[model samples]
Target: MRRAAQGMLATIALALLTAPSSLARVYLTQDQALALAFPAPASVQRRTLYLDAAQAARAGREAGGAVETRVVPYYVGTAEGRPVGYAYFDTHLVRTLPETIMVLLAADGRIRRIDILSFDEPEDYKPTERWLQQFPGRGPGDELSLNGGIHALTGATLSARAVTQAARRVVALHRLFVAPFPPPSGPAPGKGDGAPPGAPGAVRP
Candidate 1:
């Protein structure tokens, strides 16, 4: 019996060593998270807008005729060795509702970036794949030059709007709460006390 118990203990130790670290536990695998982030589009429409910086000034001025409408912009940079503009999405399983938020931060309280990560109901929320694709490679100075004219995907305008607005919210939050808060080394604090690394929010895996 003692031998059998020792074998069981050894097996448990082996499993723990092979598992992903605690930090990795909180984050879902990329594929699994993406599944929740982007949903099926209800419809699609063709529209074109010039994403160039020069064109933005022209659109902002003339701001007439057929122009781009779905213009979303974001910044990309780094802080304390971490990429600052990649969106962060967090949600709890309790409410069955999640929030996707994008945040940009500098070493201090300044927003130098943006991206809309979300906690949304897939059925009610439009997928963001198309809208997000628009901001790639855009520089910090580029304006969300929507005077160009926004393309609408037939029945998908609601989805399009959701995507655009989410981007706007992210930008706003960046400006509001832009600080370099790195992932916590310990768990989130409880009612009055702080949580340590292995508890609740502290438990990653």
Candidate 2:
């Protein structure tokens, strides 16, 4: 009986040692991601934009997905007192677990980079850096979907879809609320025909 008990304990220990871990893997923090996105000579500013119901609806329509929050936080990079780029951090579920990603955009509202900050799913399900490289330069108008413009990820379809959706949503938000406004052209100063470049009634281009 004693021998049998000892063997059972050994088997249990072996199984525990070989079992897969379920903890979330953290690759980078938000500050680290910001540093990587905007290197030296580029200063980063944190900004928050509140979206009204109408604005949120339009963004959802453009992105083909729901806007998860009305209050959004983003970062802007500037150099030589001129705009450089934008960055947004999105955390969403990939399958039953949560994953956080930082989406970086160029000054023209195109995708520049994507970095996974933390992932709760198995490492195998995370998209590779090679796969993520395809996203750079994609704009809000691009078809950023699975098998549309982005190639499918074998055995990691859910993760791929989640990341794609997040990317689309961030770009849409930038285009709608954060892109630089064009110069006022509809009316002269004090004409009362349209708002000034970035005034209340100004048209966003």
Candidate 3:
């Protein structure tokens, strides 16, 4: 009887291993993400933002994380020495595993695009690319929580929440770090550029 039980468990494990989304990679690399976000990027700089305990707590609250992850990576791009935009990824729990979402933010902090890196959830529960269209042009000021601002997925509540939270997380993190750093004071040398871009956000299309 014990042998039979062990065989059953092994069969279960084998079945799970053969499952479609089980441990299968479905997302682009970080380098690939950056490349897609910027085809002809003049420069792509990797930046890290570390938050103090208090700020960490706040970030968690904003991201709906039970305990905040303190270190975050943000990528900034430039074209011909002019600011292009910012790119970042946020990982949040959905179902059992975590999903990484790559977000491309315009220079003004509005969401330019959202790329689902890997969603380890059930096939039926996967959010469609069309569904992601709802988030473009949204930014830190908007509440991305489902039903409040963004619409909710009928069946995939957790995935919807997880992604929405992740979006909010990165935008909030951007606001906390990048927004504070004042850009070149007054008018830039040759360009009419003056001051860093503001986060008034984008108009929904």
Q: Using lDDT, give the best candidate's number.
A: 2
Q: List residue ranges in candidate 1 displaced over 4 A.
A: 1-80, 90-131, 138-150, 179-205
Please list all clashing residue pairs in model 3, or write none if there are none: none
lDDT for residue 152 in candidate 3, whole number 0-100: 88
Which portions of model 2 show Cα errors greater than 4 Å? 1-22, 182-205
TM-score of each model, in listed order = 0.31, 0.78, 0.76
lDDT of 2 by residue, 1-205 (tens): 9999999999999876655434568899999999999999899998766666676787798898999687788899999999889999999999988899999999998999999999888899999899999899999668899899999889999999999999999988777667775223323221244444444323322
The local distance difference test score of each candidate is: 0.36, 0.83, 0.72
Ranking by TM-score: 2, 3, 1
Q: Candidate 1 on 16-121: residue-level lDDT in tens? A: 7654332122234433433333323311111112123443333333322222332433333344455433333322221233444443333342333333344343
Best by TM-score: 2
lDDT of 3 by residue, 1-205 (tens): 9999999999999998767556755778788888988788468887666555676676567556643665566888889987688888877668877688898998887889999887777767777788889899998667687898889888888888887877887776666556534234332121232322231121111
| Residue 165 CA displacement from its true place in model 3, Å | 0.3
Candidate 1 total steric clashes: 19
TM-score of model 2 (CA atoms): 0.78
Error of 3 at 53 (Å): 1.0
